[model samples]
Target: MNTLSIVIPALNEASNLPAVMGTVPVAELAAAGWRTEVVVVDNASTDDTAAVAHALGARVVHQPERGYGNAYLAGFDVATGDVIATGDADCTYPFDALPDLLRTLVDQDVEFMTTDRLHRTNRRAMKASHFVANHALSALSRTLFRNGLRDSQSGMWIFRRYIWDGLDVRSAGMAFSQEIKNAATTAGYRFMEVPIEYRTRGGEVKLNALPDGMANLRQLFNHRFRRQGGRGEAGIPAQKQRSERYEAV
Candidate 1:
């Protein structure tokens, strides 16, 4: 039986964590041979994010840095599981659909699996500007990395823990979403994507479309042209240096 750690990166998501935690089907997962642990990585939130998460049966990992990438990196370092699952704490990504996704990952034995948020039926869940940017980024990623993934900005993913060892992830912002995929693809990891519903966020929207899009674009180009020869060197851990900056909460 393999362990699964579902890591949710939250920043001031005090109100949203309860619903996210409540809806997770922990018992069902355990019955299906996965000892699931929900980890809420609080990214220096001023609100009661950590306290709320702790009360809700989630182990809260505190990350002082304030980036989507930073929060997840911290969570990954602390996760004690064979497989790592990632979703947003804002409730935009569905927690109910995780069982099927996990089944696919296990059945197919893929190294990397992500969801396609573009198939979402809710028209108002995503903003028009954000949708456009997501498509542009997806196209750019496919062209640059040849990964053939539809959603470059989708936050939901499940991957083998050791797959991180082969990746040289450096993005500490929104760009981390695309950078992880690029690194995984470059390392020839098996990849797959399934459709998942994208809902409206529970709390406030945190994405800055223009700046984040520009940063993702920069990440794509940098990864394409820059020489990444020694980062994921044999025996070295994934994002080793980056993980040192964070302290346990």
Candidate 2:
């Protein structure tokens, strides 16, 4: 059976792990011939994040460094699956939609699949400021990279494990979300976005909208120009292909 590694990065998210982990359709995935390897990266949290994840049947990986990308990279290094899926441990992303998302990934032959949380988002799930920031960043990303991505900051993404080595993602912070997506698209991978239900978070929010948004903006321009100067591609890969279908949930 094929294996799917679900990697979640957590920092003081002990209160939210139960709902996040419980929503994962393990039995449904198993019936579809996919074994789920749930990995929760403990980002040096003071609380019981690691213990909670372990008790909830997740393989806990210790990431002492306190960066979103650092935790995810650490988890990815240890994940033992053919396919990799990523999300946060804050319970904002939809884990119950994974089974159907996995089907879309396979059926469409997509190399990288990211979720869209902005479309039809619940008002209570995200603050107005975040929604606006996301739209602005996504607009800049689409304009700079020509990737046609709607939600560049979405935390949930499903992709083939092998593609990780080829993509050149460098951000170590919140900018990691856009960087990874840009990297995959720039590497000529088949990409698609699916709409998913976003929910109100269960724990304290860690993001500083102004600073993080500014950092992400800088990362975007820097990445685009750096690639253009070094590879002469200008963020647009010659072999890139858009997915035939956009599966909506």
Query: Which lDDT values do the candidates have, in the order given?
Result: 0.86, 0.86
TM-score of each: 0.94, 0.90
What's each prediction's clash count?
0, 0
What tens digits encode model 2's per-residue C-alpha lDDT throughout 150-171? Answer: 9999999999998886766767
Instruction: Write down the TM-score for model 1.
Output: 0.94
Question: Among these predicted structures, which one has the highest TM-score?
Answer: 1
